[model samples]
Target: MTSDRARLREENEALRHQVATLRQELTCLEEQMSFLVNLCVASHRLHETADRRELLGILREILNNIVGSEELGIFELDAKRSVLSLVDSMGIDPAGFQSIALGAGVIGHTALTGKTFIAGDGAAPTGTGLEPGLTACIPLRCFGGDVWGVIAIFGMLPQKPALKPQDRELFALLERQAGLVLAMTRPD
Candidate 1:
């Protein structure tokens, strides 16, 4: 009887451990599913319209709702590729970022190299129209490996102090999809 009781206790403990592990895995999966839903919604919204103004409005909503950024600027690369001009913005003064020359600062560098630059990594915004505290610069790249625009996030919303790993993933999605959508939606 003693041996049987010990065996039962060990089996009970093992079952409890298995249950706890399953719970942890379930939580992680739920988080992943939630993130996936966000991605799906963002992608759907990006391709939802062909109107320029409406597209920009949807982009603003994505920035505000999904990206957790209250302040952001969307810059379009000039046909000559020499300048990035602020085409649209939200939650901040656009006077400082009226235009940026290619390779001049973080925003320009992002446009020049197609690299995303997140703040707090020894990089700062400099040059003309880039004085506002920027949180990140995401290059909008097209299929041919050309960067045609940049999405600059300035001081993420007050609730979000910093970007998360998932935020980077979402940014990557935007980099891949936003440009193509814009190109398709542009008027001839």
Candidate 2:
């Protein structure tokens, strides 16, 4: 009878160890999930910028965080004239990006299609005058069915050949937030 009791105690101790290990793993997973959630929330908050100046800063941060890129530009579309006006941006030489026209480069293509474009090549199409590099562009559109701007991201090295599903998802999230802010601030 005493041997059976000892065996039962050992089994209970083993079960306790297993439970403890599982609890630790669960805690670690929860922490990871919490981190990802905070990133998404912070990304959304970036659009809270009150003016173009603030928005430009926020845009740079978002691209750096999400796309892992340091060089980026934001171009506003003048739909009436078919021109892409260089608005607020970061990590680029102004003299290199003046009066960049719509449909002139990857950003132009995104504006024209209202779809995101990703390029792995380090070359902007001929005649666009953009510096060669891997780039991605997301069209900016606001409520009431109006296209407002474009988000352009460039990297020193060639990017992956295709946009991953996660990349598209992030761009979509930024697009929605940017549209809301642009619509709110634009002349009504």
Number of the top TM-score candidate: 1
List the global CA lDDT of all models: 0.85, 0.70
Error of 2 at 90 (Å): 1.8
Where's the lowest-lDDT run of ten residues in candidate 1? 123-132
The estimated TM-scores of all candidates read 0.85, 0.68
Please report, as a residue range, the 10-residue window in candidate 2 with the lowest summed lDDT: 156-165
Name the top lDDT candidate.
1
User: How do the residues 28-69 of candidate 1 rate in per-residue lDDT, one tens digit apiece?
Assistant: 999999999999999999888888888888888988887788
Model 1 accuracy (lDDT, Cα): 0.85
lDDT of 2 by residue, 130-157 (tens): 6466367888778864668888876632
Model 2 vs. true fold: TM: 0.68
